[model samples]
Target: MASGALAKPQMRGLLAKRLRFHIVGAFIVAVGVACAYKFGVAEQRKKAYADFYRNYDSMKDFEEMRRAGIFQSTK
Candidate 1:
């Protein structure tokens, strides 16, 4: 009877340790997914900007605006 009582506490402790490890692993995976999502968004924005600048008409319009003094002076 004394041995049975001792075994219950040991089992509880082991279960608590496993639960903690599982929680930590889940948190790590969540952080990794968030980082990947952020990187993907940044890459997509960069690609979009690159495509916008690749068109000759856009560059010509920007140059015209610059000559017309629409942008702030650099001093």
Candidate 2:
């Protein structure tokens, strides 16, 4: 005639397992997101620098100084 409450085990073990799984999953997801963000930013910066240098025209005015001997060979 006893109640069934004492027949069942506590749910602490299952709860602990579930919590552990959630914690691990969250940690992995955070790491993955951080890496993606970091790589994306790096790629953007790389592309920006490349584009800037590609169109920079550092020697755009070199023709005017070509005959000045300013950059002529010293030999």
Candidate 3:
């Protein structure tokens, strides 16, 4: 009976707790990375919009054509 300590309930509970901690830690890291990527993409889009608006008047040759989405590449 002395060797039954290896199969005790307390030991199983401790292992389960450790596993949960590892899974939660991985989840938190993944969410952090996703948020950072979202933030960076939004900043890039804002900058592009600012540049396009600033040059709207200078690019008058294709003014109406550009507005009609003729220059957009589907690929």
Candidate 4:
């Protein structure tokens, strides 16, 4: 009935607003860190792929794998 009628008023003014600002700032920092990590990983993948394709020899790799018994054909 009047359960929340004396709930000490939902926290107003400076301290409450400061808490909100701090939370928002922390959220922004977390997002920034996540984006930085994402971009770093993407750059690493790009470099790895670039290095891989830089000297890619498809048939050479296929024959190597075949020699290693990967195909089970004994070729």
Q: Among these predicted structures, which one has the highest lDDT?
A: 4
Q: Between the candidate structures 1 and 2, which one is better when assessed by TM-score?
A: 2
TM-score of each candidate structure, all chains considered together: 0.45, 0.46, 0.46, 0.61
What local lDDT does model 3 show for residue 70?
86
Alpha-carbon shift of residue 75 in model 1 (angstroms): 45
Residue-level lDDT tens digits of model 2 in 1-75: 876665676676898998999999999999999899878898889989998888666566565566566676632
Query: Which 10-residue span in candidate 2 carries the lowest summed lDDT?
Result: 66-75
lDDT of 1 by residue, 1-75 (tens): 455544445664798899899999999999999899878897889989999878759667878888888888721
Off by over 4 Å in 3: 1-11, 57-59, 63-75
On a 0 to 100 scale, what is the lDDT of residue 15 in model 4? 92
lDDT at residue 69 of model 2 (Cα atoms): 65
**Per-residue C-alpha lDDT of model 3 across residues 14-75, encoded as one tens digit per residue:** 98899899999999999998898878897788989998888677557567677778888621
The candidates, ranked best first by lDDT, are: 4, 1, 3, 2
Of 1 and 4, the candidate ahead on TM-score is 4
- Deviation of model 1 at 57, angstroms: 8.3
Over all chains combined, what TM-score does candidate 1 have? 0.45
- Candidate 4 has its poorest 10 consecutive residues by lDDT at 1-10
